[model samples]
Target: MSDKKRRQRLVQWPRVALTTGGVVLAAAATTFVVRTGDAASITADSGATPTRTVVAIPGPRTSTPPPAPVTVTVPGLPVETPVRVTPPGAAAAPLAQVQVNSAEIVYTVAGNQRPDDPVTITYADEAGALRTVENVSLPWRLTVIPTVPVNYVTASSNGSQLNCWITDAHGATVAASTDNTISATCNR
Candidate 1:
């Protein structure tokens, strides 16, 4: 290479380095100045107090006297007060008379009774016929009641015959019975 060309390249290297360093220094200084000025403005605005204005003044306070107490007396006959009873219609209705049809029975066997104990059965009287015996000849339905613990699984009806079986805790048959019109009690 020629001597002038080599000298020109060496001179350009220092200029390039100086330009990059200047750009980096300028960016850092600009960021520092912006952050410092923002912090100073925030601190000054937060600590500064508002100017006060003159307002009206009230007169001196005074204390007031307490009121006199009045005593009450009652003519008594007995130490214990007697309660007066009120009729039902004169007041609100009692909560016991309210009827709730929807209810679920939770069965749990404890103590000496086995979990799979046999259930007893009882019968409820069927509804009487509304019409006279000579006017209508309708078949009667029997209602069976199980006294012991049993869960009703399923009931099937075929013609005049109705078969039903109740199960205990161990899935054992507690009672099984079949009846036409007459109610029968079945126990395992």
Candidate 2:
């Protein structure tokens, strides 16, 4: 070929590139339009899932108070006169169980040998296991306080069976008088 023909071909190179780019852009735009139109038709047709948006609005915030004693008395009840109903030998019997905090066992000397006197009742943790051990550090004869986490206890040192009254962290009796001696189940 001659130099003049070669130069003419080189000068038209930019035009060729522009034409190719324009065709590609046009094809892309046509494809987008076809897709959009098909979308509308599909929505109008049967068995097409509609555009659904899930809206979640949060619930109202309210401040709740910690659990404490609340005494509620109803109106119009029969007023009764004070009557002594002490049994023949009930008050004379020592306190079988008493509520306490944390995890510890203390005795108030029914005797130095008694496992539980003025029995301390507490749960193992928030997990609801009864404290049942005789934790006397130095054989306490009188007023004894032992700081040990005891499990559920059943029998006394005097070869007699004792009642188990397990209480929760709130000082409320959770389990009173279990049928079994080994385990104590607290109420929910």
Candidate 3:
């Protein structure tokens, strides 16, 4: 071959190689973008077909599951006490029929004590906590559903002729006090 023809062929070979390499790089980039879901849509060569859309659906999140309900039975008791457990955004089950180690007691404080002359009344609550109610009017009645075994109430006044009584659910008198003294206590 001639010198000029050989030189021309060498220059033309590099151009051809560069053009092919550029096309290959472009095709690789397009494939990468489609696989990674970076492109929203892609069109066919003929432009006659509908554009294809790409979507990415996320998987479920990694989280700890909710705790289950627990039931605890007390010794010597026929009923079982349930420990309430509820998950997030869930309605808890209603605690019905929880009648273990509990009873209904009625407390009455009726006397000749006038309404203007109120007395201090102290009672043991369902949790065995002493709750004092001062300046209470006469003929005060309280029905306490005690969680403990026993309950009591006391009415205190200065020569008020007070009367106090504690009764059970069956209207049986557990304790009574009808003294016209400084304090009258009824315990059961």
Query: Which candidate achieves the best lDDT against the true structure?
Result: 3
Model 1 quality (TM-score): 0.24
The segments of candidate 2 whose C-alpha lies over 4 angstroms from its true place after superposition are: 46-188
**Ten-residue stretch with the least lDDT total in model 3:** 53-62
Q: Is candidate 1 or candidate 3 better by TM-score?
A: 3
**Top-down lDDT ranking:** 3, 2, 1
- Candidate 2 lDDT, tens digit per residue, 1-188? 99999999999999999999999999999999999988867765644443333222211111322232233332233333333332111223446765444443322112123344333333343233454545432122111122434323233433222334433333334334434333223322
In candidate 3, what are the lDDT values of residues 1-188, reduced to their tens digit?
99999999998998999999999999999999877653323323334344333322211111333344444432323333343434222333558853322367778787778546769999999888999999988778888888887688999986677878776664556777877566889887
Which residues of candidate 3, in runs, are more than 4 Å off? 1-102
Residue 172 Cα positional deviation in candidate 3, in Å, after optimal superposition: 0.6
Worst 10 residues of 2 by lDDT: 57-66
C-alpha-based local distance difference test score of model 1: 0.35
Off by over 4 Å in 1: 48-188
lDDT of 1 by residue, 20-92 (tens): 9999999999999999988867755674533233222211111222222232222221233333333111223
> How far is each candidate from the true structure, as Cα RMSD in Å?
31.4, 24.2, 28.3
Tell me the whole-model lDDT of each prediction, alpha carbons only: 0.35, 0.39, 0.67
